[model samples]
Target chain A: MIDVQLIGLLNATLQAATLLFIAALGELITEKSGILNLGVEGMISVGAVSGFITAINTENLFLAVIVGVLSASAFSSIHAFVTVVLKQDQTVSGLILTILGLSLSSLIGKPYVGKKLEVKLESLIDIEEPLNIFQVLLNQNLIFYIAILLMIFTAYVLKKTMFGRRIEAIGEDLKSADSMGLKIAKTQFIATCVGGAFAGLSGVYLTLSYVPYWTDGMTSGRGWIALALVIFGGWKPYRTAFGALLFGFLEALGPRLQTYGFEMSPYIVKITPYIITILVLVFLTIIKNGNTGAPKNIGIPFFRENR
Target chain B: MNKFILSKKLYRNELATFYSFLIGFLIALAVGSLILFIQEKNPFDVFSLMLKLSIGSVNSLSNSLNKAIPLILAGLGISIINSVKLWNIGAEGQIFMGAIALNFVYINTSINNSQIYIFLLLVSGFLGGAFCILFPAVAKVLFGVNEIITTLLTNYIVFGLTIYLINGAWKDPASLNFPAAAYVSESVYLPTVIGKLSSGFLICILFTLIAYYIKDKSVFGYEMRIAGGSALTAIYAGINAKQKAFFAMLIGGGFAGLAGAIELLSQTHRVSTGISQGFGYTAIIVAAITGMRPVGIFLVGCLFGALTIGGSVIQTIGVSSYIAEIIQATTLFGALIAQFFFSYEILKKSEND
Candidate 1:
């Protein structure tokens, strides 16, 4: 019984972590390209709504996911134009993007409230009885496997590719990068769009596989948590993936513990993830002496002539 | 052939912000109208009705003012912190903490004098807000942790605590099935200046005046400006940048808390999760569009409050109130674009060069 319960908890933790990891990976890319997009929450909401609507009308989960990703990417282009092209404050612009995305989602999503997705994203392998923990872990939806593969691919691209190096160079020192003839604006715009796409994927995963339903404001505070995860992981793909799992464990532990008849306020359990994030942030900042490998010019906008 | 060059303006344009707001307001109106048109409603009719319902009558105007009370106070708080180049994104959480603190004091004490009780609750609310932000401020100052993330994370934690209290310890026995604390005694209620308008409106004005004075005419304000402008310069000028940032954060938190306390004592009279309707978040926009000026905060707060009031009123006509948020966001974007132009003028490059 104990072993079975532990396996169940681990499975739940991985599932929860998949959502956070996907979103944070997108944010990691955006931040790595010298743009701070606080519109992740907004993007996720838009993606979820659009994806749900598509799924309801067409009953095609694959097409729904594509539409979700495309719409969110389009939405993020506004932030890209306002912040990157216009050279505005990233923080404020991102916040506005969030507000706009949220409101826009609600306005369009009004008709689809309380509607459920007809088809669900299914797992890759279906075994009636799992022989071990590995099987149990592998018995997740397609998005879960995609999340892992994406993490590995991202780690490889960021560490090995010239494109990744150019992104880092721009983020670290935009003036130097521009002097080196790097297309700062184009690279940052692409990076921001990529981030939006990942955020959309996370949203699609939530609606199609995780909850398999439609609800307003269902993304909740996960986007913000993903933002924190980027910092917590020091903007590294592997480290961020690990941090996502840690947060996922905390999120899953709350309900699992209650099911096991533990005596604690559910609300207190819910708050543990946030409290732990703060503690981890403080610990990391102290050990790193304020240099947590963040891109030096992460939030600053670049203008060629100004440089 | 000539290329456009962005040249920095030599003189500060004070009227630039005014013009920017006008442009932003018009942009927001256009967006709102477009959205309404898509919904098969007449944009002009909805807008005119919104204006009429929000400010046409004395009672409607009073309701708008009442709504503006919390917005002004919270906007003042945000402006204070923002002036110091710090982001106090936890204002929403701080507001809840203030309400919790006020309720704690009200429920525990047996103070008979209404004046004393109200004063004590107000102070407690301020302290509560300050206390909530203290951790994040200290973390930012001492450990060099990013306050933005820390402050935002605390919001979730505080919200959880509020839910815990209301559902468990503070749950009122008389109000069956409702997740809220019992109402306070009538003696502790804030006095009304007019129809449905609490004395909180006066408090907002008083706080705004004090903030304006501090920001425009005080030594601390000057030092704060220097510190926010450049920490290295501030150090050279014998100003403790860290200390200033800490105090500014606390003050910002206090403003949010006071808004909460006033909101509780004057409006709700009870503690519930629905006490704050994102006033803290909306106040950020209020501060942003106003350039963090105390006077601008007041004016923008009133405008947004009116928009919110009118937006809700139009819900009767099958229009979603989310239109208000959509408008507020577009206005911020428009103002941002306008600010870009105000600071940098486009110039034609000479062919000779």
Candidate 2:
């Protein structure tokens, strides 16, 4: 029989992966539409605070989740305006968004700091067995199901749908897209907002389902990790979700290993995600695959005057 | 149908810069007012209070001066690297390395001399910061990796390293339960240039002059700008872009390291991760806000320094210190938008239509 601890570890891995998958899905869609929102870190933090505050006061997960999504989308609208409408540097604006998110969240989240909630998101269905593989995999929260559905939804839209093709077309060749009469600004703006909403949903999961607490900088660098995961996944939904699961396993492995009572530096666990990102980038470039799954116009702003 | 559109200005018009910055300031103030109104406080009173506390008294002004020392150094570092069009986001890590280096030197060296050792400590700190960015610089040149990700990741790694040092190896046993690095001796502390502030301000001024000379007069500065403008063009003109990137990163990292060392030797007096408080990121914003001009960076660095110190003054009035950060970020975003207007003008729809 598999020990209870091992099963718990497996379950934690899925939970962690689900959060990353949701956020990376948002980034994937954003990047697919030729927009880079580096403000995921900021957006996630904002979502975390807003979600936590809403959960505490209202105890309504539905409202908390909506607030979380809308607030982040609202925050990222500035980015869309700057990068898409105004034709500014997207990278700088995205980074600035992060700074704004973090500072703003901390500033506004002051009263809600150190607060806790009684209710938390529970597993959709109770497990039939105590420590079985099926129980570990199937008995998960609503967000886990959302993540799986989103992956399929994203993959289907990007492959079979005309909307996905339009986004990809714009990302690949903005001039061509513009000439084709595609609404570049409108498309990018909506895609970016959706990305922000997904990112914020990840934040709600963090505060509402995962830690179920409110604190400053609680999202930590998960947003950055998700950003990297999008790249590591080669901008594909399936691959990115897989990569997130792998990362989630790695994240869970460290803590689970600590429970084994080994003398190790916990700091190693903290640095793992960061170190993994650089390594992934290095190795990916080294392989030099024919197609390096990146949106060609990822960071470059589309200037209408240029053509 | 009539619609307004921004047209590119052929010549660099000074009026555009003024108009854009004015608009940026106005937008930032408007947003700030909304927040203040929501909080039920007079926006004017708070703004004036922040201004008064920051620049009104000698003590507060000196405090701002003291704070600006590190910011100016870090900003100058960022300015130089930015001129080469290579982002050095690792300045935060570099600053930490600098603080770590000086702390190791100060506590371990047991150097009895003052002047020589202090100078040596500052240099070592600069070297420490430089070494932090060396890897990303070389990797970018040799491997074609993105420095933005690498630099940012390295910062986290070094931050973790700092936590390890403070909580574990460097933790003072006598610190009780606090778990901090060893405290520096009083003798090695930087001398005061003014009331309650250390002489690091003077050193920053010297660096500003040096930075100005390099930017305008130095042959290397000329090369860096050309390389930044267009790398393919620079290469066609026989300029080695790799060497420029290498040296540019080196200089940028060095300045940040020096800031770290000076911050420790002058103000903080010890090593800790919180010592930087995102100065590396703030310096990047400062460099951008000032248009990457050395003198502009100096003046703007002081402005940010004042804003930081003044941020604390309003907490008692039911405000959060993060309000300072919100204002700064809003202004940064506004200024970024302003740059667009500065570069372009809305051509009035002529009646010729």
Candidate 3:
């Protein structure tokens, strides 16, 4: 019975982890191309609204995911243009994009406030009768399986592909990459847009697959937590997945604690992810490992012609 | 020659500000109109009402001034940090923490003398703001953590910690359910210099002058500028980069703290969660709009403050006061977009090309 419960817990963990995994993967691609995306929350919010509205209209869940991803990618392009091309302060630009996106989403999503939708996709797939591992992991939504496949694919691309080499080079030294005839701006832009798509995809999971309701500021701070998960994972694809799972566990921990009759402040539970992030940061600092690598020029606004 | 005179350098600069302001206002109006339309309301009436309420009379003007004072102070706080190439996103947190610190001091101790009261208030405020900065500064130096994330995260921590305190430890004995601190003693309240206008507004002007003087004349300011301009060059010039950064953050935090203190003593007259109401965050827009100039911050802050006050009074015309948030956001959008002109040029492609 305890073992079955543990499997159930793990299954629950995967559900929560899927959204964050998508977001972190998206952020990783952006950061790998040397642009730190702080507009994850905004992108997610836009995604949530876009996904919810589109799903309600079309009644096609997959189409909603596509719309959500595309919108998020479009939203993230603004960050790319300002930071990569315009060479503005990345942090300020990202912060402004966040505020703008938040307000813009609220304004645009005003009509659908308080309305809820019953999604049909939740029962569309049930793989639990198949192979045990697949049943345990892939038995959830199609998006959950897609998210895992994306992680594997991303890890493969980052490690084995020539495109990844160029991205790595750009992140390591833009000047050197430029000298070597790489298209710096183009690479960063594409990566950023793709990253944004993942963030949006995460939003689709929330709207179409998870709650299937429209609420103002529904994405909440999941985007920021996703960003932190990228750091907690020490900037590796596999570790990033694990970190997302850990965060999911913490997120689910709130409800579990309540269920287990251990009454705790919801605020304290709400703060657990942040507290864990700080703890992870402190632990990372103390270990002082030389192996974990962040992109050298991650937040630096690249000005090609200025040099 | 006529064209040259029309495009004269001084006129060109004035034209820039004029165009920017016009564009910002129009954009805000368009957005506000769109929102009103969605809600099935008339936009023109709402805007007209907004204008009337904001600038209609002396009372509204005073109300706007009252709003502008704290915004001006917050803007100054933002400008100081930005001038040194630091993004102090913790101002909201700093303001709240500062208020909490001041209130803690206020409720516990009774100071009869006015001088001691002012002294303790300023000290607590400065100390509170400074304490908030310590985390980011330490994170920057020790952990290689960017101050941006640390500062931003500190905001939630401060808010959470403060709320925890008010609920658990500092809940007023007499209040029914609302979590509120004790009423501050009258001696601790800031003196009102103008009729109905609190002395806090005066402090904003004083700080602006102080900021200008320090930025222009002081060696410390020069070091900060050098540090901001180039970290390598500052180090090459025998300036202690670490010390300068630490000092700049401290001053930035202290000024923000002082704003919180003044706000509590003058306006709210007590510490509460909504004391700052995102002033610290909005100040970023003020600072950026001003291009990190004290004069610019003062003007922009006043503009926002007036808009905020005007937003409320305009509700009689059926528009929500929250429209100010949209307008402020639009101004920031305009200001950031305007900065693009400074950085890049847009030109028509030639037919041959």
Best by lDDT: 1
**Model 2, residue B206: displacement in angstroms?**
1.9
**lDDT of model 2 at position B168:** 84
lDDT score, candidate 2:
0.84
Q: On residues A1-307, what C-alpha lDDT tens digit does candidate 3 reach at each position? A: 3355556666777878998899989999889989988888888888878888887778877788889889989988988887776666677667766666676777667768877675645743566543454567656878887887899999888889999888888988999998998988899999899888999999888877667777766775788778877877777889999988888887777656776678876656666666666667656655764334789999986654421
Looking at model 3 chain A, report the run of 10 residues with the lowest lDDT sum. Answer: A123-132
- Report the CAPRI category for model 3: acceptable
True interface contacts retained by model 3: 0.14
If you assessed candidate 1 against the hidden native complex, which CAPRI class would it receive?
A: medium
User: For candidate 2 chain A, which ten residues in a row score worst on lDDT?
Assistant: A283-292
Q: lDDT tens digits, residues A5-120, model 2?
A: 88888888998898888888999999999999989989888888898889899999889989998998898899999998778888778888888899888878888877778788
lDDT by residue for model 1 (B119-140), tens: 9999999999999999999999
DockQ of each: 0.73, 0.58, 0.28
* TM-score (chain A only) for the predictions, listed in order: 0.95, 0.95, 0.92
Error of 3 at A121 (Å): 5.5
Q: Give the range where candidate 1 chain A is weakest over 10 consecutive residues by summed lDDT.
A: A298-307
Ranking by DockQ: 1, 2, 3
Q: Which stretches of candidate 1 lie over 4 Å from their true place?
A: A128-131, B1-3
Local lDDT at B178 for model 3: 71
